[model samples]
Target: MKSKGKVYLVGAGPGDPGLITVKGRECIETADVVIYDYLASPALLKYAAPTAELIYVGKKGGDHTLPQDGINALIVEKAGGGRIVTRLKGGDPFIFGRGGEEAEVLAAAGIPFEIVPGVTSAIAAPAYAGIPLTHRDFTSTLAFITGHEDPTKADTGIHWASLAKGIGTLVFFMGVKNLPHITRNLMDNGMAPDTPVGLVRWGTTTRQESVFGTLENIVERVRAAGLKAPSIIVVGKVVTLRDTLKWFENRPLLGKRIVVTRAREQASDLVKRLTDMGADCLECPTIRVAPPEDWRPLDAAIENLAAYDWIVFTSVNGVKFFFRRLFETGHDVRALHRLQTACIGPVTAETLMGFGLKTDILPENYRAESVVDAFRGQSVAGRRILLPRAKEARPVLPVELTRMGATVDEVTTYQTVQVRDNAEMLVGELADGAIDMITFTSSSTVQNFKALLPEGEPLERLLNGVTVASIGPITSDTARELGFTVDVTAESYTIPGLCDAILAHYQRL
Candidate 1:
């Protein structure tokens, strides 16, 4: 007999990636193979190691991508081979995720297994929409039921009438198709016709949408609103609280589409923060940074470093790349014994400090204007200032320093080129209306977006209805120049501020 492996049936939590439990993340990280369902958020896959094999065993109503028997066999086969297997499911695996059936199969095969619980949509859906399952003033109990069942069975075995009268709150999953039947049953079973009910679709995600109406008219209202499946149906007075406690949708940048022009490597944090506030982020890299085309200029700059009075780093990228070159040439920050270092922002200053170099000057505000202002009124006659930055970088620093009577030697430490093909796949997404918004963090992103967009009136028509979000005045000007209206701009020049601006716009509507 082969040595059996351990299997973990892990819950991925309701739609929100942050809601995923720590233990579930641990299991996914260590698992050799992860079999996941379609409903699970793709973000959760990031927790798995790159070497781990991922298998999709998602099933829809009557359509099975991988049959239950096949999935069961796969799990058992992998476990029997002594590989650590993780069965990742959306929400609580045990709660209608068919985790019990898989557990039984694992047990019958004598495979060791453990279950990691998650925040089930049964509770999280309502929570994200501010609908509590139970309220002390309204009700003390809650019931979770499925809206889908086998029609061939003798009966669902649920006492609808008893539940309608006895339960304070009733939450149903997969109930969109049977909304009419469920509403009628509840009404006939002594539930009030005017009882509040809400259908939350794509809960806890930026795409989340909520429809509210009484039991008497919810079916009609949802139909009129074109609400789709993968929704949670809540029947209770708690549904009324959404109007007052709607904090998620109140973020500054909620529902606005902003385009981030930063490189892929640097855009994750900014994009995540913007998306969390309900803003749809579009990533269009206006500038692609690459190593300098020739090392002569960089080598010469390093060798004559002591002749310069000041070394100004315009970006964190320049700081990083320059230091890497310095190390390659077998010289450290100590070699710059007489050069004063000036950084544009706290982030740049911190990066310089990481290399054991203290910044001599850092501005309170993080902009080119601020950096130039910090050195204003200081005598710069005959002083040599070294500026190592991107090839296409703005000439504000060099021009302004020259005006200040300083001899500036500008070196292209890196090249920032336009990305032409990044939007190839996104064209289909844009045409299909899957892209709800496009956010612009900088003027360059707006320019690059227009360059990448497909030609003609189709691009304009596509962007017409899509909300345009800007990070600041400069980005807004670029967006307006592209013939698109700016929908929202952050009060502060930070990603979180941009998000808050988006949310504020949506909440006002």
Candidate 2:
């Protein structure tokens, strides 16, 4: 007999990644294998260890990835192998998620298992849309029923009479397909023809769409609006609350698909900001940061750290690598007591300060030219400066310093390599007119992104309707030189500044 492992039937919450419980996230992080559904936020998978296996068994409309029986067998098989399995489903695993059925199979197989409850869309979708499921002023009784009833059953199992007349609020999931049938059944069962009804599609997501009409005309309104499946239907007077409390739909960037062109390691801050404002963010990391090919120059610089009068860090990567090697070779921050540090921007300076080092100079603008201008007014004659930066970076700073009577030793601390993952999906998004904007944080990002597109696909026509955003003038110039129209440029060349610029651009329209 094989030693059995534990299975956690974890609920992934309705849609928002933040809505996930702390316990649920921990299970995913420690699990050997995670079986997640389509309704589960992709962001939640980020918590899983890189070594974990991810299986998607999402069923939307009639398109089923894995049937229920297959999923049950897979869970039992995985657990029987003595591997911890986290079966992540959307909403509470108990609430219409068929979690009970899978749990039964696990029990029959004698597999150790536990259930972690999650926020179901039946409650969260309406709440995010600002419709309370239960209010004292309205009715306190609430009923949650599946919109998709089994056709093979002798009759519809739902008590239509009780739901129509007795229940104060009726919430149905996957009911868009049977909207007419649901409405007719309710009205015929003594429910008022004028009952207020609202359907929220893609609820609790950035792409959420809500349509409001009475039971008499909701079907027509839903048809005209072209709302599809994966929606929640709400009945009773609570439907009227949407008119006064419609908050999520009013978000500035809601429904806009924004592409993030930055390193995957560095895209989280920008991604969170945009997603918080209701934008669908796609992380297409253009450049991957890694150790330089030759560490001799940087290694030598670290050994002779006291010889240099000033150390100039052009990027956060530079500061990170410099100190990492400094400590690795048996050096510490105390070795820099006699040295002064200069940085290109506040962000770079902030990164430097993180090491308990003081910044002697920070240029007014976040550009190499600004760094040069700052040095132009200072005393640089007969000074030795050490610069550690990207291998492919421009030589503007070092070249200008050499001409200013300063001996400069520039070494590559890190290099940015291009990443081509999901380029096909990116091209498809553009072709389908799904992307509304693309943001570039650096010149390297801009160049690498262009290289990812299919060869000979006219950039002009391929990105005709999409807006191009730049972090600053340097990136904007690179974008323009590459024949992309720069639609928005940040005043402050930072991720937060870029977010503000993007929001302001949409507001102007």
Candidate 3:
């Protein structure tokens, strides 16, 4: 018989993927199967191993992927197969998430399980909207209640009289649809009609929205604002603090939808920076990086490392792939002791430094021309140099080095091929006029992105109002040659530079 498996009941936190607890994330990463809900941030799936089985049991409004009982059965079935299962639910699983029911079922089935509490939206939503649940001057007591109780029951479980008179603050979960009933019950139970109330929707995310009013008029106000379910309702003087404490919604790029056209593996840093600053980044990786068709040339160069005087790296990918191949071939950084290293940018240099090697030359700008200029002062009379980089990279560096009397052997370390996986969705978004800006980080990204566009469509008309941003002049030149209007170009030629340029462009507008 197989040994019994363990189940982890993990709370995935509020809508923000960053809000998840470290332990919860660990559960996701180590689990053999991940069963998640609708409210759980889809981004959290990135933590799961590639081989992990992912099942979505999302229930939103009236639509249900799997009912609560079915979900519980599925969990038991998976865990019974001796697999480590992670049940990922949105918010604090114990709080109105039916987690208690699931846990009880697991206990009856004799399954091993652990509970990982999550950041519930009841508190998180109000906090993100700038409303503190308690204040010394206003109220020091708080209570949490559910908005959607069983309609079939003859009596409500909530004690409205005590809640209105005793509690200093009230937070209701999933209460938007029953806003009128909630407000009326409070007023009827002697709560002041003038009591402040606020509702926050999709809180703690880029799409968070908030509305406020007094109990007497809040239902109408919410209706006029077009608020829906899956919202947090805060009832008390604490709701008034939102006017002075709102921060998340005030970010410079709060609602701007931007597209990032970099390779998927390297897009996270740029995506996080833009997301933190309040831009909703749509990752459309136009190019995918892979090993070259043949590794013999790179292997040969590595085998004869002693003959080279210098090894130059033009991009982060180049440095990583070269060092990786070197290690795979039973060689290490010690073999490069006789060679000087030159990297095009600080990022590439930093990557090289990770291998315990120091860079001899780093250009101020991250382009081939700047690398060539930086090499002007070096003595290259009859010196042998090895250059390992992308197959489609510009030849300016090698050409200029040859002019300075250096015999350069250029070998391909990586290959970048066009990816059209998201092309259809991209064109749909562009046609819908949903994208505000598109960022191009390299010439290859710009080229591949252009190829992804549908044939015979007027490019000018499709991207009419969308701003085009380039990482540097080289990328901007490529965009222009392809008939794209480059609206913003970074002066410093890096990811941070591109972000800063985009921020400045928006600020000026």
Candidate 4:
């Protein structure tokens, strides 16, 4: 007989992926199988190993799903087969999540299990809406009550009339459908008809929405607002704090739709940071970098490295592709012996440094002009300069080097080709005004954005109400020439600075 494996009953927290506890994330990463409920955010599943099997046991209102018996049996069967099973639920599993029943079954089946506590929705949902459950002036006591009960229960144990006066604040989970009945019950039981109430839907996620009103009008207001299920209802003086405590919606890029035009592989960090700052990010890769069409030029450049006095790299891709060719040609960083190297920016400089070649000149400010200034007043009449760069880069460096009387050899180190197909989903989203902002990291991105989009709907008009943010002046200038107003520009050309710029803009507004 196979040894039974231990089971982990984990709470996934509210809908926000980040709200998941450290313990919950650990179990999810190691579990052989994950059984998740509907309320748990689907994003959490990405943390599990690719080999782990994911089983969905979520039940929506009035929807038939895996019965409790079957779910419990599946857990036991998997554990008995020596599999580590994770029962993932939204919020604290033991609190109104029917985790008690599941635990009972596991215990009866002799399957050892551990319960990992979660940030219960009862607290998280209200807190996300900026409502504190307890306050000295409002009320010291708070109560959590389920608006629904088991159909076959011997009695509806809760006394509505007594509860109306027993607690200072009342939080109702799974109560949106029965809002009318609940409101009437509270009022009929002597609670004030005008007590403040707030409904938080999709709490803790980017889609979170809050609707506030009095007990007498909240039902009608929520209906008018089209509030859906998976919402929490809070009724008490604490609900009044939302106006002052609300901060999430006020983030710098909170409602802006931004477009990211970097390669998909390199865009995740920037996209995630922008999204976390409350901007809706649209990923559309305008330029895809690939190995050089032929490495002869780069190979020759590496062979004659010492013949050049200066080697300039304009982008990180140039450094990467140039070195890749060097290695392929049986050369190494030693090939760069006795040559002064200049990088246009920190990113390029860091890439070169990674290959054990420290940059001799990195501009304090990252720009072509700053690079030119770095070598100002230096004699170059007899010096040989080598430039390994992208095929379509600007002529500024070569033109300036020629004017400086230096013998410059500019060779293409890599190729940047356009993506043949436009992302239909991104286009559809743009057409429907679903986007909030568009971020351009380069002039190429701005130009490509226009190229991918339909002609008549100029990028400016397509982004009429949306904000256009750029990483620096060059990208901002490209956006301006294309007739789109630049909304935010980072003080520094980096992702963190871009996020800070976006946040500062919103904070000032």
Candidate 5:
């Protein structure tokens, strides 16, 4: 007999993907079917298994992809099919997310279910806007009320008089549209017209916007700002604390949409750093790293490791692929016991160290020229050296080393092929002026990204106003040669340095 399936009502948390709880992520990872809402960060969808059937039941203002009743039935059907289902909702599922109704339906259907609580936007939005719901000196009472209650009901479920006189802090979800009604009811119930009010839209995310005023003028302020729904409204003296406690809004790269052109496998660190600094990163990997088609060259070189006196690694990919192939070929780090290694960058050196080998020479600058300069001090006359790196890598290192009387056997450990799957979408985004900046981490990324662009439009016109950032002078030169006007180039050729350069570029603006 087939086992019974379970439905997990998971809270996806407010905007930030990092805010998701461990259990919530686990549920998403293990689910066979995932139903997600509009407010749930699309970034969180990365947690879902690739084979999982993803369904978007996002409801915006009055536009819902699927009605509540239909969603309820869909989850039941998926669960009854013996598939593990995860209903991913934004914020706390139980707090005004209609999750209670869904749970009731699940219970009625006799389906086993679990509730994974998320960080509700009610508190999270106010906090991100620097407004604490309750401060000991300000007030101890807090109440969460729905801003968009049922319109068919004859009267509001909220007791205006009790809220005005009893509560110290009031947070209303989905209240931007009902701002006037909310303010009028509070004041009519004897609440002060001058009570502090704050509205946070797209809170806890890079697009967060905050508007502040008093109950008397807040509606006008929101109107002037043209703020729309999906906003949280805060009413209390605690709203005044925002002026000093504001942090998320002040991030240097906040709201900047940056495109990362590094390989997806290597782009995570850069993406995390940029996201942490408040940039919305789009991982449009221009190239993907793969093993060389013919491993005979690397294998041949590895088989006679004792013949080489030195080994040089160009990048982290080179080090990783070389070691991976080395291990696969039944040889360990001990095979290189006699060879002294030279690495181009600190990251490559660190990766090499992970394989129980420390680089003898680490260049001050992370480039081919720097590697050549580092080797100038060593005795290289008649020395045999092994070079394992990308197939499309520059010939500068081998040429320079050969000039120094060193016999360098260059072998391809990895190949970086152009990725075209997201090319059309990227071109559309670029044409629509949705991208703020595009970052190139290597010469290949610049080359492949240029190749991904369509031919009819002038390259300059297509990328007009889009700031171009490069990891180093080489990559910048590649971009410039391809008709791109480079705006930011990292002083240091590293991911963190690239992020810092992007931040500094915005700071100057």
Candidate 6:
């Protein structure tokens, strides 16, 4: 006699992964089992607990993974077993999502359930494309209708007459396939042929594209543009406003597919910045950061922090891993009060500042030569300096410091290993000339990316027409040594600098 668990039919919102409501995200985090749809952004899955079981019940038009009855039965079975289930739908569940049918099934089975509404594509897609559904100047009334209907029904369920004449604005979801039928039906019902229309594909994302035409030629235009399903179709005089109001399509980096070569854990900021600028960023993390095989040297350095006059950090990972080891050994930030801290760049300095520590030295440029120059006027006749950094980092900093009469004890805090999760996919994309650019943030990312490629694959052939963007000169030199034509270099050697260079290159084109 086990008690039943509750089910929540939650809406995942429109295409933008960020559009999901906070409550919807919380439901996913707490759910014991999550069943998501094809339209739901895969990025939302990161919110679910790692222990939760995720099942895909995606049902695209004419391609049902699980029939409606089967989906209903699956939910009943999971809830009966006392597992909380989150049924993630694309848009507002009650609107054309068949949420009512599933809820009725759960009700008949005596399962406790709740419905969570989402921002439907009907309104969101058009809005992201810069079209207002209702306007004081255009039309005041709006209607939402399905572009496809059931074949089993003997008659069409939609009222074509009222929609044509009465509705001032019309939005059809999943309507690309039935464009001809939809246009003919509207015109037959006395809708004017000259009425404007707009089709938005993959709206609200970096890959979003919009196509515009009048009702008389919209179908042909959609075909010419090769717009696919999961598109939003807007009809009526409101579509005319898209030309004056289109903002997303006019972005500088729109439609450009760029690859990010930072480590997976560190790629978020770079990815977000590029996506915000309308680049379709592919997160291809080249290396993964991890603890060194042995912690003895790092522990020894921490135990003797009082003997050192300077502690230098070369990367954000160095600061992160060094502090992690410090806290793990029962020491806090106070242990470093006797030592002055120096960082190579602003990003590393910011990470150190996050731990309530101030930097004594921050070089203007992000390089070992710059750090060496920054310490030229200081007296280091007999100062002991401790550097905790990547295992395979360059030795120029320590070598130069020792010449300046300083005793430098460099210890390895972390190591980076190459990752090959999608090497084959990357190769395919490159071979097909689908990739437009590849960005390198560090020398390690550049090295590991070359290592991940198939041995002896000609770099020139792979990057024939692709632009190579580097964060700084050090990274750019490494890319050049590998025979890559460096097209853009960030003057500031920062994430935002790299993004600006990429945009500037495109703007010039």
Please report, in order, the local distance difference test score of every candidate based on alpha carbons: 0.83, 0.92, 0.94, 0.85, 0.93, 0.91
Residue-wise C-alpha lDDT for candidate 1, range 1-509, written one tens digit per residue = 66899999999998788899989999999999999987888778888999999999887666789998899999999989999999999999999988999999999989999999989998988888888888887899899898885434777667998889999999998989889988988998999999999999888877778899999999999999999888999999888888887777666655455556677767887888777667666666666778988978988999889899999997788999999898899898887889888998677788898998899888866667777898885667789999998876778888988988899999989876678766875666677676666777667767777887777755576665677778777678778977878888876665666667766777797
Per-residue C-alpha lDDT of model 6 across residues 171-199, encoded as one tens digit per residue: 99888998898898899999999999999
- The residue pairs found clashing in candidate 2 are none
**Candidates sorted by lDDT, best first:** 3, 5, 2, 6, 4, 1
Deviation (Å) of 124 in candidate 3: 1.5
Task: Give the Cα-based TM-score of candidate 4 against the true structure.
Answer: 0.78
lDDT tens readout by residue for model 4, 136-184: 9899998888977553466776788877888899998888888897898
Clashing pairs in 6: none
Cα RMSD (Å) per model? 3.6, 1.3, 2.0, 4.6, 1.3, 1.6
Worst 10 residues of 6 by lDDT: 147-156
Stretches off by above 4 angstroms in model 6 are 150-154
Q: Give per-residue lDDT, candidate 1, residue 138.
A: 84
CA deviation > 4 Å runs, candidate 1 = 1-5, 61-63, 80-82, 151-153, 257-259, 282-290, 293-304, 324-333, 353-358, 362-376, 399-407, 417-422, 434-436, 442-448, 455-459, 467-509
Question: Residue-wise lDDT of candidate 3 within 182-291, one digit each (tens)?
Answer: 99889999999999999999999888888899999999999899999779999999888887998898889988999999999999999999999999899999999999
What ranges in model 5 sit over 4 Å off? 150-153
